[model samples]
Target: MMAFYFSRLVEIFPFFLRGLWMTTKVAFCSLIICTLIGFILGMLRSSNIVFLKRLIGTYVAFARGTPFVVQIFIVFFIFPEWGLQLEAFPAALLAMAIMGSAFICEIVAGGINAVHNGQWEAASSSGLTKLQQLRLVIIPQAMKVIVPPLVGQYVLLIKDTSVVSVIGVMELTRVGWVTVVRIPEGLMVFALVGILYFSISYPLILLSNYLERRMAI
Candidate 1:
């Protein structure tokens, strides 16, 4: 029976590939959105503007404070009652965007803050506007502080894609769940799932390590 199930898994390998594809799509899209929003929010949070800082701080607190799966459920289940109906895929992306951006926001804000105030003062003395200062001076200096942890956060976000399986997003974990029912071999099915996840995450892990080493230098 083990051999039979193993063979069955082999035959349905393509299905897993499809799930992998979906997982990739979700992870990629969410990462892009998260990075962009996180940077903007991070920059604003790091700014001297008190109101923007407070507003973003509240948002960050909510997103970081709550469990991700609970956030996913709120987006998928609760929003419909408020007349916002989203399909599973979009809902997954929304939840990811919310959670990922909050974490990245903190990372970026911390990075920006790590840059000495003298850098900002020097940039200002050079007649650079706030935006110009960030673009030409602050952000570049902060990149060393930011890139490693940002990449590490990306790996976490990618793994978090599996949580969207709870919403029927048909990602790798979902594929494993469905397969296990038919194959009746939980370990084998999920080992395959884990391997697929590792394949995607391992490269990012390597990149994160590389960035950390480079940053430390």
Candidate 2:
């Protein structure tokens, strides 16, 4: 079986690599959209206005509470009823971004809030407007707090990309499933898949640790 499988490994190698590439692409696209939307949501989250805060709160809560697959199905199938049509890839990307952004927003807001009131007072005394304080004073300092958690979120997003493959996104998990089915070795297939994810995720965790250390945290 070992000799026979050695031959099959060569056959499996190329498809596995292709699947990894596709998974990376989906994760990258989702991260960009999520970060952009999250910045907006984060800013809104810290606003003094109650209505704006509540509006963002409702969105964050719902997006976080529901499962991503459920969101994906809803966006792909349900939106057409409201004249909002989206294909599978776009729909999946949209749902992933929204779910990620909600979490990112909370992370950012928490960081901002951590910057004590004294910091805000000092910035205000220096004639910094609210916008200026946020841009120059608050955000830069808050970034020290946010960076570690944000890195964790990014790793999570990479793993979560595996879920999108349920919609036929051709990501890493889908590719592994295809390989496993062909091999007739459930354990071997899943074991290889786990190794592949570990290979991707471990480096990210190391990077996060490095950044935290550099921050002296």
> What lDDT does each candidate get?
0.96, 0.86
Give me the displacement of residue 76 in model 2, in angstroms: 1.9
The estimated TM-scores of all candidates read 0.98, 0.92
lDDT of 2 by residue, 124-154 (tens): 9999998998999999999998888898899
Model 2's alpha-carbon lDDT is 0.86
Candidate 2: list runs displaced more than 4 Å: none
lDDT of candidate 2 at residue 108, scale 0 to 100 = 90
Q: Clashes in each model (backbone N, CA, C under 3 Å)? A: 0, 0
Best by lDDT: 1
TM-score of 2: 0.92
Task: List the pairs of residues colliding in candidate 1.
Answer: none
Best by TM-score: 1
lDDT of 1 by residue, 1-217 (tens): 8999899999999999999999999999999999999999999999999999999999999999999999999999999999999999999999999999999999999999999999999999999998999999999999999999999999999999999999899989999999888999999999999999999999999999998998999
